[model samples]
Target: MQRILEALGWRQGSFVKPETVAKLIGDIDSTFTISANNLLVVASQSCDVASSQEEYIELSIVRPLSAEAFNKQYSHNRHPRILHIEANSNSSDEKVILELKAHEKIQIKKSLLEEFKPDSSINFLEGNLNQYIDWLAGRYKRPALPTKFDQLIASSDKKGKRKKIAKRANEYLTGIYVDIYPNRDIKDEETYSVNLLGIASNDQSIASATDALNEYADILKDAGMDVSVPKVGTEFKISVGTLRQYQRINFDYLSYEENNPIPPDTGI
Candidate 1:
């Protein structure tokens, strides 16, 4: 989990800075409620460096749910839920809340098995399931953009500058999956697979996307993170295709619903 947060650009701290916490939720006499199960880490906030846009960083921490509680709430449903808590009375001022259980990883794996059915005659190699899980969790949480990147994008409404910043942002990797399979007899017998995915522009080629991802990994390494660039391959194509199809179906359904009128109900 520390590795995951570090990869997402969070710096671990014994406590979230007093000033930072105050800035986020306004002044309070009591300190943030930290527990043994959860600790806070600061995320570098970025905004238009030159503009009057308020520049403030965000702090995030994860609290793990117990297996018993998790199973009782989500075992049958198998879907992670999110709730946003509004700090002030204003609806716009809301804080993100993410919760995950011990069983979620296994449940996610089971869902993947049902989706792919890898063992049925097709010799499909499983990618890093952990990476997929991380991606699933992280995709909902927005990462803070680099200040410079944000500045570049906001400096002008020019298409070229926007495209350039978009390209750069696309290369920032969000999730890393490490696959582990156990051996029956030997404790040391295991195979490791790592998979990473990044946000990229629609027009970017696979090669360009891969290069951008590697560059981001290099940046993480420079920051003293124990990170490595993995060879980009076709492991995620199946999921991509599935998502695209699902999106298309949803689009069509929404379009139909929008265009068609509701039939008047007859008393049955």
Candidate 2:
């Protein structure tokens, strides 16, 4: 009999061939068709891959993603279902993005996986493999925005400065973390104070983010609560000493998201 805990060529973040992926997938109508530039990515955890206790492995459909698509298109859609594997992560010259479907995974029996090992498994570069795993786990545990807060975000595109504010915040700043006091047990029509914090990568972006946060307060003015935003600055300011005061707003709450669509991309 074959050894139960035999070694395999694949690891947690391994990238294998299309044929290998097809063998693993039992029978699901997935887009398993890999192109010349595309390859199969292993999503199973490294520990799991290493341990003999685990019986199965999971994989994700992947395709080559140009830097243009990474920056302009898919990058804007930061939803958990969407993930991009950077080109620098591997020795390969091209980048790839995961094509995750609703739990319809390219699963295979661990014993069967031992049948063959990939020629060479490509994993993410540096600490990115760990980061990818963390992201996968984080998606399930991610907190939801208050219903009222989501409503406020959805309403930002109604007109005037709100559009610019929403565009700047969502498109440029990327996130507006808020701490709304008394958010718990809020009754209908009840008012609550909001403290805003915008997150950005650089000083110039931070300045713009601060302005976006202030402009967002204008939208929140009629959103049923007192809104306070930090002023434009070269550095991020925080309340005396409480990190709890600045919770990052979920990207799902952004109006530009398909999740909270203002007008479902009318194909103009």
Candidate 3:
């Protein structure tokens, strides 16, 4: 039952917010009014009788967001709203019943009363409610797992094996930081350097990072920006001396070999 509920997107610790309920119902029909905890769905076409004839569907939240509330509510009394359908100019009376329970798993039951007329168009209302249930199910469905990546990682987790799976997982889980700088000393306005940090020192990881950076640079070039292939270990110097003493520059503090430098032409 727990697995079934989780598959339907209902996490154990999460609660369905009232706003979500309102949004779901609004998606189905924007005219449906939410008064307190009850959803008022008017199933009639008559404007005059629309106010009095409304199907009241009760919605409540449990700790796990299951169908427990529906079971408890319907166990006592069933008659909540009488659905009136106009079929071929004939008015027919039908009762709206909603039942939700978890036997082996959570199940949904929504239908009209047994007294449905032969030519009644109550199926339209039933279809709408069924669609709403489908939307609700999707709303609570669980997130999909990264199956292929997980499998690849798990395959390396055998005994005496160098836990390559864990390493692979960590590679994807880690974040990369990039510092972009323009080559201020260079006469070429298109010259720029992008320093990527937090990448694994392994050759394969470095190659992959370089390939990704090249692709990004290509995208920028395609967008009318002048960017060149990044060269590793490029050096630049910054002058930190006063305007009067240009020769007394502090090359140690402003060296691009130690720190990332931004080019003066890039505006940033």
Candidate 4:
């Protein structure tokens, strides 16, 4: 279990996709209290059963910490943080069958007995539990953007007030002072925190500013918010301070003044 946890780091992968999130939800939804036998089965199924150990842990102890509430608090996107084996030893059959189904229909027909010579003493592991959780967090963590343009509009009219405009201006200028991070998807929430570093204009109208803002919007869309022009003639300036450690700022393009030095990427 320690090895498994060590292997599953902070990055996303195939097994750690959205279905793992659904499975975590489903597991919590199905049982209010997990039986001791179920916990033992989960533990047994997760690890290779070389031999039985007498000091097997209790389900009550593991279930609560391994439950959805724990996941909601610790694991991003409510992903399962713990993996355990579940063993069922009561089957009377000499052959074990593994089914890979797609929507209740068999996708690729393969029976364990036919595929590999059946050994009644050995148990076949069903799924890669670690990868499933990674995939889940990767999927649900970044939600999709809305289909229509109206959806991007701020619901409150006061959102465009002078105070808010000043705040947004600060946010954009602040972008030049911080280190920015990469975004995995357009709907990512962390992207909103980063500011627009600079802007360029093709024309003088509000529409032109909107177009430039739209370009920056494309850069930040995957991060979180949509782009819109501030009313025409909106210009602001600021003197950059020393960047905070680990804070990031991003720009679509950047130009340095003559004799000015460029910042280094921290690779966080």
Best by lDDT: 2
The lDDT for every candidate, in the order shown, is 0.29, 0.55, 0.28, 0.27
In model 2, what are the clashing residue pairs, if there are any? 177-249
Misplaced by over 4 Å in model 3 are 1-198, 231-268
Model 3 alpha-carbon miss at residue 162, Å:
32
Q: What is the TM-score of each candidate against the true structure?
A: 0.23, 0.70, 0.18, 0.18
Cα lDDT tens digits, model 2, 102-165, are 2434675666666666536355665667656654664454545455555654565356565456
Q: Residue 85 deviation, candidate 1, in Å?
A: 20
Clashing pairs in 3: 8-140, 8-141, 9-140, 9-141, 9-142, 10-140, 181-262, 182-262, 182-263
lDDT, model 3: 0.28
Candidate 4 lDDT over residue span 46-77, tens digit each: 23212123123111112223222332112211
How displaced is residue 99 in candidate 4, in Å?
20
Better of 1 and 4 by TM-score: 1
TM-score, cand. 2 vs. native? 0.70
lDDT of 4 at 176: 23
Which lDDT tens digits does candidate 1 get at residues 1-268? 3223333333211123333333433222224453444423322222211123323223344343443333322221122232111111123333323343322221011111111111111110123223223324433432222222223223433344323432353333212222111101112232222233433333335566667556644433443334446334333443664322211100001111123452111010
If the candidates were sorted by their lDDT against the true structure, best first, what order would they fall in?
2, 1, 3, 4
RMSD of each: 24.9, 6.1, 24.9, 19.4
Q: How good is model 4 by TM-score?
A: 0.18
Give the 10-residue window scoring lowest on summed lDDT in candidate 4: 100-109
What is the clash tally of candidate 2? 1
Native-to-model Cα distance after best TM-score fit, residue 243 in candidate 3, in Å: 28
